[model samples]
Target: MTKEQIIFLHIPKTAGTTLREIVYAQYAVDRITPIYRDERFMDMETFSQLPPEKKDAADIFIGHFAYGFHQHLSGNRPYKYATMLRHPIARGLSLYNHLKNLQFAGSEISFSELLKNKGSQFRNNQSRYIAGWGTQKMLETAIQNIEKDFLFVGITERFNESLLLASHDLGWQLKPYKRRNVTSTMWATNYADQLRNDKESMQELQKLNTIDMQLYEYANKRFSQQIASHFPNAVEKLLHFENRLHQAA
Candidate 1:
């Protein structure tokens, strides 16, 4: 069997940090290329420029890049793509908290003010990231890409099931790992209550992330169908995996 090359499109704030730990446990560190960190490396173009030996040596390509990175591979190695999706409203809030906590761009503004001031990139970010643009056609393209290109698209809300399904398909022994990169602000801690108390803000957030909301709904439906069709024993397996993880902990 030709070994499969896995491309993990690690969308920001989607439990990607924990997923990376699981991946690192399964694959040798040198075989995994962390492309998200270096802004100099423009996904496919930079990957294409790598020497053939380096290209063949890497087993996984992971980062915040979009869907088309696999097209840049030089060899005949078959690749499978995987990603996790989050509810757009929650993701947006998490992103805002992350930036605020880190004192990054837009950290000084209130969430409402930030929404008003930030670019479209901050709005329907998941859709923009997946489709590589923020057009209606691009949204359709993103859905098509998920349908055709991805081997497994997981939901961040269903982290354990997602991990178990990916491990089963990829033949990896991925145990549950510690979560990382969590938002650490008091506001973030009470985000759910804040949203509950501020109906207008929640509505505004939904309105702003219309594209992402649609995309997330689509991905979520497909994720459920995938579990039902491909991983019938997923619940049992997930339970077992959790039990094992707890025992280890």
Candidate 2:
């Protein structure tokens, strides 16, 4: 049987960098196409124009794009999609900190201010990315896509279990690796302290991402069902993976 091509829809601030490393390690360098944040190949116009041979040679496509890319690509091969979702509030905070770290041109704006900005992309970003639209239909379409099309949907809070389930489905022998692009624990602790001290701001941020919060809850429930239905020994295997990961650390 021909192996299905893997399409990883890497949502931001969801431990995607670490997962990308694990997935990439399983494939030969020449057999994978990493779209990542590369501007040249990010848009559909450029991605669709890749030489047919390059598309044919690649077995895995990892990227930050939304769901529709699979339909646009030129190929008859079957594709299996997977993605991880983060709690909307947590994701928003992480994104805020990441942008702050980069000293973005408008780095001085408060997280709440940024959320209120009309042009801000970070608000309800997960829902927007998954649905590819800004209307109520986007949330409906995103839930349907996840339920009907994705082979697996995972939650960042349950990272080990998610990886174990993905490995089981893909028939890969995955091992834990050191995390990449992580926010430091010290900074995270400080941020958490600030949030605790400012409940109003935190609440506002949560209110702003209502769509993402709903989507995340839906994804989390489906993730649990997927683990239950598909990976019977998921808990056991996840425990083993976590133990090994700790020892390596």
Query: For every model shown, what is its TM-score relative to the native structure?
Result: 0.85, 0.86
lDDT tens string, model 1, 172-210? 775758777766443434344455467787787778888
Let me know the TM-score candidate 2 reaches against the reference structure: 0.86
- Stretches of candidate 1 off by over 4 Å are 38-48, 104-108, 116-118, 134-136, 184-196
- Report the lDDT tens digits of candidate 2 across residue range 65-166: 877767766667778777889998787677766665564544566666655663245678788777765446777888888777677777888888777777
Clashing pairs in 2: none
Best lDDT among the predictions, by candidate number: 1
What's the alpha carbon RMSD for model 1?
3.2
Give residue 168's error in model 1 in angstroms: 2.8
Model 1 clash pairs? none
